[model samples]
Target: MSTLEIKDLHVSIDTEQGTKEILKGVTLTIKTGETHAIMGPNGSGKSTLASTIAGHPRYNVTSGSILLDGEDVLEMGVDERARAGLFLAMQYPVEVPGVTMTNFLRTAKTAIDGEAPSLRHWTKDVKAAMENLKIDADFANRNVNEGFSGGEKKRVEILQMELFKPKFAVLDETDSGLDVDALKVVSDGVNRAAEQNEMGTLLITHYTRILRYIKPDFVHVFVDGRIAEQGGPELADQLEDEGYDRFLVKA
Candidate 1:
């Protein structure tokens, strides 16, 4: 089994005012086939952790290490990190105006695998995945995420994950802006990837609503850039009832 390890990670970013530390000495590990949920209040560095893992340049690693199977993740470029089997589904997916979804998917698949997929099998796979995600066939010809609703954008993100089959997926508030039906569809896609590929997940969210669909093996409460508590699925249930009020008070 592959392992993604974060050891004493401290990340910061420069804002208009000054350089602000977002993650303070945070550490965690994820193994393929495990699902870890990070629930927290706004501005608690959960997204920063996700972005850092994806190698976003905006977040600087002031200290600590991110390792995938003992290889230094922090040393890799963003595309290099993705080729290493790390994926991030952004909360607000950006629109790619000039790129068609079909071309984009195939090109990305080729880049990640270091070889182009056979035309016949690639077409079949793309069609099946889009259908399963309930995305319209015409979207294959449309520009990536352009003019799509929030739910549609999120669905496309999952489509990428399902196709890419990354070793670990960092989903940053994927359930946000999705309706109950859309939520189920997205959650099912994530579960399918985990079951089929043994993909580990680091799910970041604020509410327990998504937890009802994507069951997590571990729940971590993030407060003030640190994990305040960790527990099993029951911890999510407790958060649903008690909320992060106590954690905020302590922070």
Candidate 2:
């Protein structure tokens, strides 16, 4: 079974000043076919947790450990972690001026799958995934997010997730900066992927709109760089109504 475990994770980031801890004693685990939602305000360390899991060089795990399928993740580099079935979709995707979506996807697929697909099969797979997401065929040739809209960037991230089919995924703010139509398309693409695979999804977002489409099994509240609360889907409702005001008082 695919499983990701985070135990007492404390991530400190170095800046102009000294190091500052972003994730404080955070512990969580997700298994195949499970979806976990992480909700927090801006600067609550949600993105830091996602970046650290993906092996961002800037974030240091000062104390604690991360494991994927019982293997130490800290021992592996970013590429190694990806090869081991960990994927992270960023809140803001970077633009690569010369990289076409097709080229990027093909290269990533070959690396993640550990084998190159036949040309015809590769085209078919790519086309099928794009078609399901209603992405224009021309998007295949467009440079990776060079001038794409905010929604388009998020959709491209979902497309990558579909093509790579990682065992565990950390999606940071996948629903942010998206309009209603774009949100539906991106959400549909994500559901299409998660529905077909026994995916372990750790969806990090501020709002509940995306959750309406993906339906998380667990909702976690991140406050003061730690998990202040956790519960089933109903917890999302509570947060929407009660807000983090109570959490600030208790946390």
Top candidate by TM-score: 1
Clashing residue pairs in candidate 2 are: none
Please report, as a residue range, the 10-residue window in candidate 2 with the lowest summed lDDT. Answer: 189-198
Model 1's TM-score against the true structure: 0.99
User: Which run of 10 residues does model 1 get worst, by summed lDDT?
Assistant: 74-83
N/CA/C clash count, model 2: 0
Candidate 1 clashes between residue pairs 3 or more apart in a chain or in different chains = none
Q: Per-residue error at 6 for model 1, in Å? A: 0.6
User: What's the CA error at residue 113 for candidate 1, in Å?
Assistant: 0.5
